[model samples]
Target: MNPNEELCLCFHVTQRKVANYLRIENPRSASQLSDCYGAGTGCGWCRPFLKKMFDAHRAGITEADFPTSSDYAKSRSEYVKKGGGTPPPGATPVEDLPN
Candidate 1:
């Protein structure tokens, strides 16, 4: 996802926000990312990406591996359709998706 794209769609947490949080907050583990605006706590789609970012930080890499925003949102919509997760009330709807 792009820096401005919503990585955690359920809570509207952007990739930039998570990246900054990972850098500034210096969380000890991937799970600690939840404290950064309820990121992966909702539909759970972004958990892997969050973990990926954390792992990269620990490895001293500043870059992250992520799908394009469209691909990510499309996958998320598919996941939702398959009942992989249910987004919270304030989350971006599966049908309406991404900002």
Candidate 2:
């Protein structure tokens, strides 16, 4: 193989690029990864393979095991406090937190 040929025809992502992202960023989820690396933003054709790589990067057996950006954001003390969960130790008002 030439090793530089694009794999995800939709996104023009390549295997080496994906591997580099896994090495450099250590992203937590496919969505987070997409935000940083633009993985699944095209025609959704590379989703399966991208998901597979993302899962492997996170040491997960499946993508479902990973957290969505919303999930992580919602699970934060800010959302929990809004949802009625007690603020965590050293918690600050959402407005006071850095934007």
Candidate 3:
């Protein structure tokens, strides 16, 4: 996903925001990412991604590739359909993804 794209859809947190947080704050743990505008605290879709990014940062990798925004959104739609998460009212609505 693009750096400006929303990684945490529920809270509208971007990858850039998280990355900057990681770089500037040098958080001691991945959980500290939750402190970045309530990133992983939302519908749970971005938690794994956040952890991976955090790990990458720890490993000295500056950037990690992600699926296209379209693909990622579609996957989140499926995840929500399967009851994997409950997006809050202000979240980016789960789109009715095409098969």
Candidate 4:
């Protein structure tokens, strides 16, 4: 994922922001990331990614190992199908999101 890409689309939180939060806060679990500007709270679209980041952070990984853009798109599609709000303008399209 692009660092500037919106990981939590509802809150417009970017991958860089989440990574920074992880480095600063040293949260023990993915849920704790919600405290960072309500990252995984809204719509829950970013939960999986949050967990991935959290696990990576706990493992002392400094490099980003984000899921493919298509994975994000598939997640976003399911989120919207379940009544979550639409992704912001310039967000990745659903066709790109699905597996």
Candidate 5:
């Protein structure tokens, strides 16, 4: 995924923003990313990506380690199957969320 691309669609948060947040705030866990303009709080599609980025950042990995957009979609599908995130109202099927 492009660093400037919208990672959290609902919040319009970008991967760069998340990266910067991680670098500056040094959140202890992935969930702490929510403090950064609620990056992983809405829709939940970006939660897995957020975690991946957070882990990579902590491990001193470069942004090149970030997963592709397709990978993020696939992982997010599995995450939804595992009941990892909360879908907002009217978000039936849980596969897609409102913009």
Candidate 6:
């Protein structure tokens, strides 16, 4: 198995684990995952791999489940707030955007 698969296997860390950390813990960036989950603290070797997992996890979410635009907007606003920018005008509200 690859290193990422190996870490995932050894830690039993799933895409869900990375996703939950991003969604619930709201890690603002890749470095934060290291602080939160020891995901990137090792020899600096697995950092990029961990980040890819996190990105993949976040990228896998869907937006159709949110019931309202306002709720979706709120989530989008939060993501942008964490992301350090105003959301683009064309940007879909949170629930609508790619995870």
**TM values, all candidates:** 0.92, 0.49, 0.95, 0.73, 0.67, 0.39
lDDT (0 to 1) per candidate: 0.90, 0.50, 0.92, 0.77, 0.74, 0.45
Highest TM-score model number? 3
Clashes of each: 0, 0, 0, 2, 0, 0
Candidate 6 lDDT over residue span 23-53, tens digit each: 7776656778765445444333334556765
- Candidate 2 clashes: the total is 0
Candidate 3 accuracy as TM-score: 0.95
Candidate 2 yields a Cα-based lDDT of: 0.50
Better of 1 and 6 by TM-score: 1
lDDT of 5 by residue, 1-99 (tens): 888866775577788899899889898998999998878776687777788898898899867355686666556656666777765543323345433
lDDT of 4 by residue, 59-90 (tens): 88866576776677676888787777655554
**Over all chains combined, what TM-score does candidate 2 have?**
0.49
Ranking by TM-score: 3, 1, 4, 5, 2, 6
lDDT of 4 at 41: 69
Q: Which stretches of candidate 2 lie over 4 Å from their true place?
A: 1-3, 60-99
lDDT of 4 at 81: 78
**C-alpha RMSD of each candidate structure in angstroms:** 3.3, 14.4, 1.2, 4.0, 4.9, 14.6
Give the better candidate number (3 or 6) by lDDT.
3
> Model 3 over residues 19-50: C-alpha lDDT tens digits?
99999999999899999999988779899999
Cα deviation at 97, candidate 1, in Å, is 12
* Model 3 lDDT, residue 53, Cα: 96
